[model samples]
Target: MVAKGFTVDLNKPLVFQVGHLGEDYEEWVHQPIVSKEGPRFFESDFWEFLTRTVWWAIPVIWLPVVVWFISMSVKMGHTVPDIVFHSGLRHICVTLMEYSYIVSFSYQTKSYWGNTMHYLLHGCHHKHPMDGLRLVFPPAATAVLLVPFWNLIKLLATPSTAPALFGGGLLGYVMYDCTHYYLHHGQPKKEVAKSLKKYHLNHHFRIQNMGFGITSSFWDRVFGTLPPQGKDVKAR
Candidate 1:
């Protein structure tokens, strides 16, 4: 049975605590709070700090790696134009596949969740919309996921070719992460960014199910998940 006044204890591992809610986590998590901070996933300060990251760190740590990956392709005699064309295509395909997964997962997320599973996946973003530290994917988690991804691309191409394609995809990931942070925190004076910010926030505050596309609403339109606009509506 759930405690009558259950609240998340942020200073400890969250998975066990959230699991205690069983099916109640879905409804409990959607309620938003405006704070610059987020839940601590671990009690140990060292481990807990790994759960958070700043917005600017994305480009600093990854852009050089992106350049290095593309350089490998150059060494194999691939021209700059060929690399750009193929890499750009690969980037687009990866993006489409990503948003497609987001759309599917958006609809299929059940009311019952795995303790802190939903929080880890996306619930925390909704619950604490203004928490800038948690706004982007932490580098630690990204590094972990890249291992299998690094290997997967190798199967589809020779050793010389796979890293170049992966580099394109890496660039796409970097762009996606950077853009997600901007949509939340960027104050746009121009109309286009203002509109994009409005659209992204709509998914957070107005309709969580729609606007699964974070970087642009183009895929949302393609997937038929765009918010209904009679009242104006709008993710990362």
Candidate 2:
């Protein structure tokens, strides 16, 4: 969501009026609450925990598939093109299916934890975006879904293809996380970041249906949900 300016005081009680997902822009209510000043990265007790969680969980989810694909290639003496085409197609299909599942679940429940495993995984961030410590997903929670996701991938695609698709999908996840974090915290004077930051802020402020594309607006534009450009767009 877009703040008119970045003048939020973390040390004081602030009231945020958040629009519910799919709710009309005018329906927001002022929610007054006190929050502690979140610890800085180096000083936070959870810093090491967050780091280890991301490090361990990501590899656990995608590495076995990588090893499997490598072994399969060695065994078959497959060419790079053969691997790319076959495995890439499998990865794409599996990734799409997984994406659908996550989105569906998130929309249905409106809770990030119940829906997916990315930063803010579901819609929790929409409810509490300014909660700095909770702004990003905790690593331990990410580990919880790895086995289930892998098992689902196994059922949908061949062993060789599962890793490639999963790996590509993982790359997408990384891009999403980085872009999202930057959208919240980066001070970009360039056009691209300026546009994305404004787009995402609108998702927070005015148009929730639009700007669902975090890393890219590819899907948002295709789905006809993109918010209108410039001052004509209403802000709640």
lDDT for each of the candidates? 0.76, 0.48
Model 2 per-residue lDDT tens digits across residues 165-184: 54554444444555566676
Which candidate should be chosen as best, given lDDT against the real structure? 1
Q: What is the per-residue lDDT of model 1 for residues 35-148, given as tens digits with 9 covering 90 to 100?
A: 777766666888668768998898898888889988998898888887898689778976796687565545323333554566776777887878888888888888888889
Which residue pairs overlap in candidate 2's backbone?
1-201, 1-204, 2-201, 91-165, 112-122
Candidate 2: residue 205 Cα off by (Å) = 1.8
* CA lDDT for candidate 2: 0.48
User: What 10-residue stretch in candidate 1 is worst by lDDT?
Assistant: 106-115
Range of the 10 consecutive residues with the lowest summed lDDT in candidate 2: 25-34
TM for every model, in the order presented, reads 0.88, 0.56
lDDT of 1: 0.76
Candidate 2: where is the Cα deviation over 4 Å? 1-123, 232-236
RMSDs, each prediction? 3.0, 8.5
